[model samples]
Each structure stands twice: as C-alpha cells, then as structure tokens.
Target chain A: MIGTLVQTPLYQWHVDHGARMVEFAGYSMPIVYTSIVAEHTATRTAATFFDISHMGRLRFDGPDAARFVDHLVTRRTADMPAGRVRYALVTNEEGGVLDDVLVYHLRDGAHASYRLLVVNASNHDKIARWVDVHRRRFDGQVEVSDLTNSWSMLAVQGPNAAELLASLVDCDLASLHYYTAAETRIAGKGGVISRTGYTGEDGFELIVGANAVVDVAKSLMEAGKNLGIVPAGLGCRDTLRLEAGMPLYGHELAEEINPLQAGLEFAVALDKPEFIGRDALVAASERTDVPVRVGVELSGRRIPREGAEVFLPAGASPIGGVTSGTFSPTLQRPIAMAYIDRSHAEVGTELTIDVRGRHEPASVVALPFYRRPSGRESTS
Target chain B: MKPEDLLYATTHEWVHVAADESGGKVATVGISAFAVESLTDLVFIELPEVGRQVKAGESFGEIESVKAVSDVYSPVDGEVIEVNEVLRDDLERLSQDPYEAGWVAKIRMSDEAALAELMDHTAYQKQCADEAH
Candidate 1:
C-alpha cells in the first residue's frame, strides 16, 4: 500500500480555486487549476503562481560553509557572491546526478556565512543523507539542517511577473538582477525572494515561512487578479520547463546519467582541484559512444512520450529513448527531449520515434523549442 | 446527450445503435464525457480506416493528450463504415461535444450479441463512481 502523501500549505487554497489534484513526489499537488494551456499561456504572457513547497530546502552555515558547499555540488560555490543563486548538480560517487539544486548564497545570517540549497522533493531524504556523509569528511566547522518543512516556496513567473510581484513585496524588483536573491518581506511576512525561474521567463521564486505562505500567496493572487494572473500547477510547470529545454531530475538526470551527457557542461567545474564524481565525469566525457540528450520535434501532432524509442532513419536498431515530452502551449506543437546516439544528436538530424508501435517522423532540433523575445540574455 | 440512450463499454466508450434506411444496424461510437475529462488536453487521435474490421474489446484507435496516450477500444465487433475525420484536426470536439458531433466512427455490426453485454447509463454511472474511490 502507498503511504500517505503530504500536502503543501496552499493545499486548501488550490482546492478552493478549482485545482485538479495529483500525487507528485509524495505531495498532493495541483496538476491544473483550470486548464493546462490556459495556465501555461498565462505564465508566458502575464503572471502565474505555483505552489512549489514540495521542494527540499537545506541551510548550511559556519566558517566552513562555503568550502563544504563547493565540495558538494558541481558548480564553483566558493566565489559565489552573497545574494546570488547558482544552478548546480549534486552527483553520487559514481558521477551520476543525485539531484539538480539551486544553491543560494545568502548575504547575512546568524553564522559567519550561510548557503541554502533547494533540492527536488523526491530526492530530499537521499540528499540529506548524502550531505551528512560528506560533512563527516570536512575538516572545518560546518552545520547542515533540513528546512524543507519549515519553509514554503512559490514560483511567480512570466514576462510581467516581476512587475506584478513588485507591488506585493518590499524588495526593489526592478533592481534585482536575474539569478540574484534578497531577503525581503512579502505581504508583511519575512521571506527570501530570488529573481530566478524555470519557465524560461523573467520571474521570481519566493521562499517564506510555512505559516506565512498562504497569506503571501493569497495577497499576490489578489494583487495580480486584474493582470490575468492564474495559479499554475505541476502540469503546466512540466510543459513550460520542457519548452525551455530544462532537464528534469529523473527524466534527464538520474542515478545512471551524468551532467556531461545531459548538455550541462557549464554547471560542472572541471577546473576544481577535487570534488565528488569529478573523475567519473571526466572519464565519461572522453567516451565517444555516450548517448547525449537532444531535443526532438515531431513532424506531426503525435507526442513522443517518455521511454519511447528513437530510431535512426530506416535503421532497425533503437538509438535512444525520450525522457520528457509535451505539447508546448507556446509553440502549439509536440516537442520532446531524448537521449540519442551522440552522432545523431545534431540539429536537423532526421530521426523517427516509435510512438505506440508506429514510427513517427521526427528531427533533432536545438534545445529550448520556445524562447521569449527578451530571453536572449543569459540569467545564470 | 442523454447517456440513457447510449450503451457503454467498460473502457468508457459509448455506443449508439440505430437502424439505417435499409434496416441494417449501425453503431456510432465515441468516448464518454467522463473519459474525455479524465484524459485532458486532447492533442491527437488516430481512427481506423473505413473498411477495416474491428473486434469487441479490441483497440481500434488511439488518443493522445499532453501527458498520456490511450487506446479507444471497439465496443462491438463490426466493420468500419465511416470515421469522424474532422476530429483529427479539431480535437477539442472530443471534450466539447463528445456525444454528438464528436462521435469517432460508424460501424456495421457483424456481431449483435456483444451489445447486450454492455452497460446502461445508470450502470456506467455506478461503475464510474466506484472507480473514483
């Protein structure tokens, strides 16, 4: 029998707003509020709110906090300025990704320095144990604590998200650069607001106390109601991120999949002197036969779902399988991300996807099937 | 559309049987409104050819949503007579009017015995409620 699922602080609020609930990562989360396409379009054009409290929040402090964080993830955290957030991967000893996390370096805390790591909810327990095991090897003073239950995260995303949220928060949303965070107040509640998002749009992620999350969410929704703000769910979240070509933890990165093959070379700091999974990633990078992740756009309306085989033109053997697939609301077409033979991972490479026994025509395209007009500038 | 006039398959497909001008029994088939809502975001559909033969309980077509793909099982053994080709271009019809304009296909029944085994509207409603729990 399945264990009881957890509910976020906004669970009742979502139900009252006509959200369709679904079980995801041990949490009873909303999959859609009204319609997936409507919510997805709202996030792209106006503003949308997502209850992301299911994510794990870990806080580290002490003199050795910076050093310990650098050793844990693939990104170079030692030089990360305060109020900055970096997307990084935590890999196992064998170089496989444990989880993709956002490492935020807070400006001030009770300790000498503090670093917060926001991780995937499903991998929370596994990552907590992983951090504990690695902390034993560190020589300096460091303390780690799991703050997942104490905090709730909400993602306010879209082109107008920053402006809409600025009215509700006490921070200077205009001055806040993308990927930078600030300790601020939302609806009179203390929280951390970061100008970061996964929807390939300019947005902010607000992390507030569990008790104050509902009030903050309600306040933001009320303020943005006139601006076409909709409460989004896990369904549109997947499609938005997929349209942006972001790799999900289980879909693109897994216990057996490393960051190198997933086209996340920038996150891995190869120049670092020592780190977990460094050697394994170095070895895997030199291999020619490694399957690389690539985006595929079907020539027709049929979606190439996860685990669907990808085959070379007229070739009998399967080269790879789709990891994540969706009908992009922005593009209004079916797109997918797949791990195909590196030789066939180039843009415009013709291929076929075995969609329910039928080989549908497809072609390899560049990552991120959709990009906003002002999205050319890199946030991270 | 009233569910009382239609027969339902356990797979959630609805069948409307009527006599043509020549007195031959023809079955019009489509998925129920409940199934359409459950699937959500209809994106693509594949229907059987006009001349193809289908068996009761056998998959005759496919429907795809953003996150899932499902097969539309034939409710009674029959030879495909006509297909709702317009649905391939306008999938929203499947959810907007699943009972009338969204009917997937019409078939000339080869085996009438299968129709008796299908459920009525009330029985189907009870089955849906039981599955909800």
Candidate 2:
C-alpha cells in the first residue's frame, strides 16, 4: 500500500467525497476533490473553498510589536494599517528564504481581537524557533505566540466569492478589498477574514473557531451551489497558483534560494532601514551575471517535470534547472518554471527542455500562465 | 464492460483474438474498465506507430489523464497494423466505450502461439480479484 501520513481536518469528509488523499506538509490533504480539471475551471469561473487550517498562524503583541516584526520579516509592519495585509518573505542570516508568509496585521486581540502571521505549515517549527530567538533580543518590546491550533482557515476564492460569502458574514465582505483583513462573525464564530488567497482571484481567507470549521465548509458549499463554489482539493490549489504564476515553498522558494534569484525582488524592500539578510540580498542583486527565475511554456503536451535541464539556445551546456512544471488546464499546453543563467532569463527567449534524453522546444514567457479578474475596476 | 471471453492484463489492457473482416488472426486490443477508471480523464493519446513492428508485452503508446501519465502496454506479440485515429483526436471516446469505440490499436499476430499465452476471462478475473485488497 502506498501509505503516507498527515491527516487534514477534513480527512474523513475527503474519503466520503471520493478524494484521493496524499500527505503534504504533514497533513493528508485532498489532492483532488471531485476532478482536478473541473475544480480548476470552477475556481476560474465561480468560487471554491479550501481547508488551509494546516497552515501555521502566529501572533505577536506588546509595546514594541511592530518594530520587532519589521526587523525580521521583509515587509515593514510598523507602517502597515491594522486592517491591511502584506505578502513578505522571512529570510535567514544568509539571505535565503526561511519561508514565505502573509502578515495580516489583524485587528483582533485578546481584548482588541487578533492579528495573524500565517506561515507555511512545514516551516511552523522553524519559524517558531526563529521567533523565540528574536523575541529574547526584543524581550520588553513584544511577546510571540503560536496560535496554529486555535482556528480553522478556509480560502473562499473566485469572481463571485464576495457575493457568496457576504450572506454568511455579518460585515460586508465585498468592502474588505484585497490584501486587507477584518474581525467579523461567520457561522456564529469570531472570525478573522483576510482578503487574501493563493489563487489569483477575488477571495477571502476565513479564520474561524477550529471546532466550527466543518459547519462553515458545508454551509458555504451549499450556499454557493448556484454560484459555483467548488470544494477544491490541494491539487487545484497547486495548479491554480501555478497558472497565476505564484511560487510554492518547495518548488520556487527554498532555504538555498533567495528573493533576487526567485524573481521576488519586488517584495524585498532594500530601503527598509535594517533587517536580517538585507546585506546578502544587496550583494545578490548587484551580481548582473546571476541567474534569474523565468517561466517556460512548452510547445508540446509532454510536461517537463522538476530536475529537468534547460538547454539555452546559445549555451554550450544546460543553463538552468526546472523548479516546477504542469500541464496547464487553462492554457491547454505544458507550462514550467526554471532558473536560467542571466543570459537566457529574458522573456520571449526560446529554449529547449531536456526531457530524459530528448529535447522539447519551449519559449520563456511572462511568469503567470493565467490571471484572475482583480477587484480594482479597470478604465476600459 | 465487454463479455469476458478474452484476457486482461494488470496494466488494464484486454486482448481478444477474433477473425478479422478477412482471414488471418487479428488481435483487437483495448483498455479494460479498471484501466479506464484508473485514468479518469482521456487527454492527448499517442497512438502506436501504424505499420511499425512491436513485440509482445512491449509498450505501444501512451495515455495521459489529469492526475497521472500511463504507458499503454501491448497484450500479445504482434505487428502494428492499424490504430484508432478517431480516439486519438477525441479521447472522450475512451472514457465512454473503452472496450468497443474506445479500442486503442489492432495488430496482426506475429506468432500464433502467443495467443494461447494470454490469460482467459476467468484467470484474468482471478488476477484482478487478488489485486483489489
């Protein structure tokens, strides 16, 4: 038997719905809910809900709270409004990514409600240790707490997501906007709804009482039936992010890689007075000859998988390696991401993917293979 | 599900030796119901190179579903005579009638002795039963 551990909060629900469960990030997550394609298309068109409770949510509070967090994390939390969220990467001393997390400068507190620092599930222990060591140095300023077990997180995403969720929450979910969070009541729970998601769609992440998760999941599924809310599995989550050109930890972000090489220079604020790994990030950016991550779209259906070599047009040898590759349901073709030597990283540059022994032709395209409709109204 | 007069392979291929529209032994090969179920969505299919020579139990082509990539193995020894070109473009046919309209390839038996080597319906059923657990 191909047995892998890690059970999600909805493990039993997954089996009942014919989901093929696989262990990911120490949890047996449903890689597919009903069908991968159906779920992917559903998220693009309507809405989908995902149980991301497996992610780690940490909280920090005290007088020096903002500065303590700003010193270690990429985004300057001191200037961030209470209701807003920021996408940032926490780095090691060597400037490599420790983990990519969304800092929701939440309004909630024990008295004021709460604020959440959502980290990747696999990096919870590592991040907790990092916080403990950093907190000692800034002891009087703030106190760090890991609250991953206190809540269940459901990501409701797609075009019509706001309309579907507004009926359940007490507040106007549509007014929350993107990258912002708020304290609200949903399904009779003290909920923290963040206007954020991995899928590139108009969405919200609902953090509710851990015990009341199943009630919300089932209710949302029933309410959004006509609105097309799919109970997406992790498989759809991966493909959707891939299409939107988002980076995953194991694939795009890793301890050995940094923001400069990962095409995440925009998130790294070099001017942020001082923070961990800033010096190393500067040195990496100065190297013009350094390789940059690029997205590759294969011409054929033969999907180039990870560890596949990329043979640049003018290079004597393979210039880079594939980080992630999938047969895109949106594009109806194979798409892949690779970190090529600086010379071949330019967009529109053609390249060949070494699949086993044969060469499959491809072109370097813009990062995201697909784009979801954003909340900002366009002039056109 | 087709009538169990023929044999099935672990890989989900079924082989039936029936007299062609003409005379010589022709092996009509298709994927089994279990194989069709295993590979849910029928995407791009690489048909066996028509008229190409192939050995018994060798991989003739490839099939891709949403979740996995699977190689379609040959059931018996034969030379590739024809392929279902219709199913190549419209893969949904495989999900519909895997044993009939969804047939993959046809072969001219290279050796008459190879036909008897395949498992019959009863033996193939037993093999499938043993694997379920």
Candidate 3:
C-alpha cells in the first residue's frame, strides 16, 4: 500500500546539493548526496552529518508519564534521572520487538515528568498507535503527543564531531557525556543536543524545531566546512550501523524476533516490576534453543544479502539466515549479521552463505566488525 | 566508443557490434552510462565466464551497489568470448567509464536476428528519459 510520500524540511537543500532521492518509509529521503563510500569514509575518518528528521519523536508528560512509559517498554524508565537517555525496546505480548527506541528523560523544569521516545521511521505509526492504545490504562494521568512533524533531528558523527559542533553551539558540547543530552542554543534557536549515534565513533545528535532546521543545517555546514564535514545519506547510515553491530528494526528486530534473540539482552530490563512483554521475556531468558544473532565475515568480496541461508560444510540443512549484509567500507570486505543456531554462534566457527547460487565461505566472527580506537576521551 | 554509435536494450545495456580480424561479428557489451549512474556506487560485479552460452534478454551477470542488486542482462544471443577481469577488483571503473573501459563481456553472435530487438541510440535515449520521469 503506497501512499503519498512526504518530504523533510531539507528536501530542497538535498536536491540542490545533488542528492539522489529514494522513497523510504513513506518519505522522499536522500539515499546518497555524493557517494555512499565517500560519505561513509568521511563519517569514520573526519566528520559528517545526516538528516534524521524522518524518525518519530513522541513525548509523554504528566505525573504518571514515567510509569506509563515503563509499562510500555522493556526498560525501567521510571528511574531514569533528568538529562538521561537509554536504549530500550517496545515489545508485543509474545516478547517480540515492536521497535527499538531511545528513551530520553528531558530536564524541562516542569513539575510533571517529561519523557521523549525516538523510534524508527518505518514503525512510527505503529508505535504511536501502540502507545495510544495503552494510554487508556493510565486513566488520563499521562498525556501522549506526537512531535515528529514539529521537530527535526540530525546526527553529526566521526572522531572530529565534537570539535566541529563546539563552534556552532553556545554550550560546551565537549562536556556532554555519551548518552546524555543538554539544552543549548544554535543559530539563536533553542534545541537539544545528545552525544549519541549509531556509528561506531564519537558523535552528537541534534534535535531542533522543524521550522528552524534549515537555518541550523546551514550554520552547521558553514561552521564545519574547514573540518571536511559532508552531508551523508541513509545508504551510508545502514552500513555504518551494521559495522557497529546495531540492530535495525526490520532486519535484526521484528514482530517475531525478540530482543534476546537479537543480542540486545541488556536493553530488556526483565527485572522491572511489570511490563507488557515481561512474562514472555522472562521465559525466553531461560530457553537455550533460540537462534542467536552473530556477526559473519565472508572470505570473498561477494555480499550475502538478507534471507540468504546459512549452512555448514557437511550439514545438509540450513542453520539460519542472514539478517543484514554489506561490503563494509571500513573493513574493506563483506560483513553480515546472521541469526544462527547458538551452538554455531561462536566467534571462530566456520560457516557458509548461499549468496544467490554460489556458496561463499564465511566465519562466525564477533559482532561489531569495526570498533574505533579506544582511549579517545569522548566517544560512545 | 561514442554512445551514439552503439545500440541498446530496454534493460539499459549497450551493445557495440564490430567485425573482428577473423571476420566474425563480435559484440562488446556494457551497461549504459545512464544505468551506471542510476545504480550508484557499484561495489561488486559478477561477470559471465568466457565460454558460456547466453540468450538475448537473459540475465548474464549481476551488479551490486551499496543498497541493491540488479541483473545485468545480455543484449544479444551469443557465446561469451571474454569478460573484463578488471571489474572484479576495481568496480569504480564500471561507473567511471561505462561505455569504454567498463565493458563487461564480449560475445560471438551465433545469430544476428536478435539485433532487430534492440533500440538505436536516439530511441534508447528517449526510453531513459521517460523512465527517469
């Protein structure tokens, strides 16, 4: 069912800058501006920014907001202090992931608690309705609102991201810790800046008013020109996240794939007092037969795409399938995320992928095929 | 060779027919410049082997970009005589020089009747323009 696609505030800017537009999640989004490899490299080496305005941003307020949110997600959000953000999962009754989101506890200086949820663009409508349907239990004590159309989000990532953003914002961004956000003024407009990103590098995500986003983007570009910052697109974003071993909603996560199977056990707070998927997750935790997610490195350059079957050299039946795969720009080879039998999920176990008609040699490697050098004081 | 001198298939592959020293009709095939540009950032190309028989409009190879995979169809029916091994390592050449250095395979046509099914350069340009819109 294809509906009319909406455009972001930066659509014209993307077009004027030579972006190749593609329809993504009912929006006309840029798949690339210059090139995927170039944009990916810039984010890994220098600095780059992405227009992440399409992601859903939901806000909940009122005295019972924290409890209502904690009931909806797997993480225990009621205890999150102001200015804190946590990665959490929204799951169905069967413990399958509905969406993986970032829960932000904002410090808005209001008497009632304020919580913000950033969800995947593809699952925006679904999660919004899920939150609405469950809000009835709160008996109007908690208020739910959708801020997706009114706000714009951007991510500036790489090793030099902090240094580049420091010149544009009024606050000392270098002081912001990872997974923490602060209210700051950019181009004379108030916004929220968080030191979090999907890339396996240091970065910050900026959320500003939709009307003021174009100005903010221009200012960031002008300030970052000398630092070699490029405008990246969703194509590189997928590669960047895959290299970081992040679970994409539709790939590693789905209605039938729980967080536990996706290797996101840390995000699921099973110890929480009560939640929608608590019972199923509690049962899943004790089970040892579920296929687990693992990283795979192919010996050849041919990429193994999603749905490609995984097998052993001597086995007649497939063990599992690939969830995501790409020719990693950083690793300079083919890498993938696969869900396979837990017994074969070891770091060095040999496997094979049926890439189209050819069976390519692959090995069960560690997740996060690429990791930035440590000892950098300010990266996540 | 200039694109105007070549013929094209509806699938966006360009065909350049020339007589070899042995007086056999050899067709050098590569994806059109328009196709290469649209399939941005080609990461890998699986070329057909030298001695493979391929039918017209049949998928003879695959070209992979960062986001998608597309089949590279044969524009003429023939036996593949040569494949550009250079593309196996440096896929950028396929996008940079799609009409010349990026040629994927060379085929010795067993029958020339398939040439009638192709479009001339002018007609091919119109087809691309319509699809882009």
Best by DockQ: 1
Arranged by TM-score, best first: 1, 3, 2
lDDT of 3 by residue, B40-112 (tens): 8788898998999999999999998877789999988899999999999888888889998899999999889
Candidate 1, residues A1-380, lDDT tens digits: the string is 12378988898999899988888988999999878888889988898999999999999988889999899999898898888899999988889999999999996544345899999998999999999999998899899989899999999998778768877888787778888998888889988999888898878899999999989988998888888888999999999999999999889989899999999999999878777899888888888798999999986888888899999989999999999998877887889999989988889999999988889999999988988886532565
TM-score of each: 0.97, 0.90, 0.97
**Colliding pairs, model 2:** A6-A28, A108-A113, A108-A114, A109-A112, A109-A113, A109-A114
* Candidates, ranked, DockQ: 1, 3, 2
lDDT of each: 0.90, 0.80, 0.90
- Every model's DockQ: 0.63, 0.33, 0.61
How much is the lDDT of residue B91 in candidate 1?
Answer: 88
lDDT tens readout by residue for model 2, B1-133: 3647767766778887877777877888888776776566456788998887777778888886655567888877778898999986788888778878888898988777766667777887777677643
Q: Distance (Å) between predicted and true CA of A194, model 1?
A: 0.6
**How far off is residue A195 in model 2, in Å?**
1.0
lDDT of 3 by residue, A264-291 (tens): 9888888888999999999999988999
Give the per-residue lDDT of model 2 (tens digit) for A1-380: 32556565667776887876677777777777667888888888888888898899888877677777788887676788778888899999889999999887766545552346899998988999998898887746687787788777889988878888878888876567778888888876778887888887778899887778878888888889889887888877877888889999988899899987888877899888888898888788788776678899988877777899999755569989998887788889888888888877778998998865568899999978887555441111
Candidate 2: count of backbone clashes, pairs at least 3 residues apart or interchain: 6
Candidate 1 overall lDDT versus native: 0.90
User: Where does model 1 sit among the CAPRI classes?
Assistant: medium
Tell me what fraction of the real C-alpha contacts between chains A and B each candidate also makes: 0.58, 0.11, 0.58
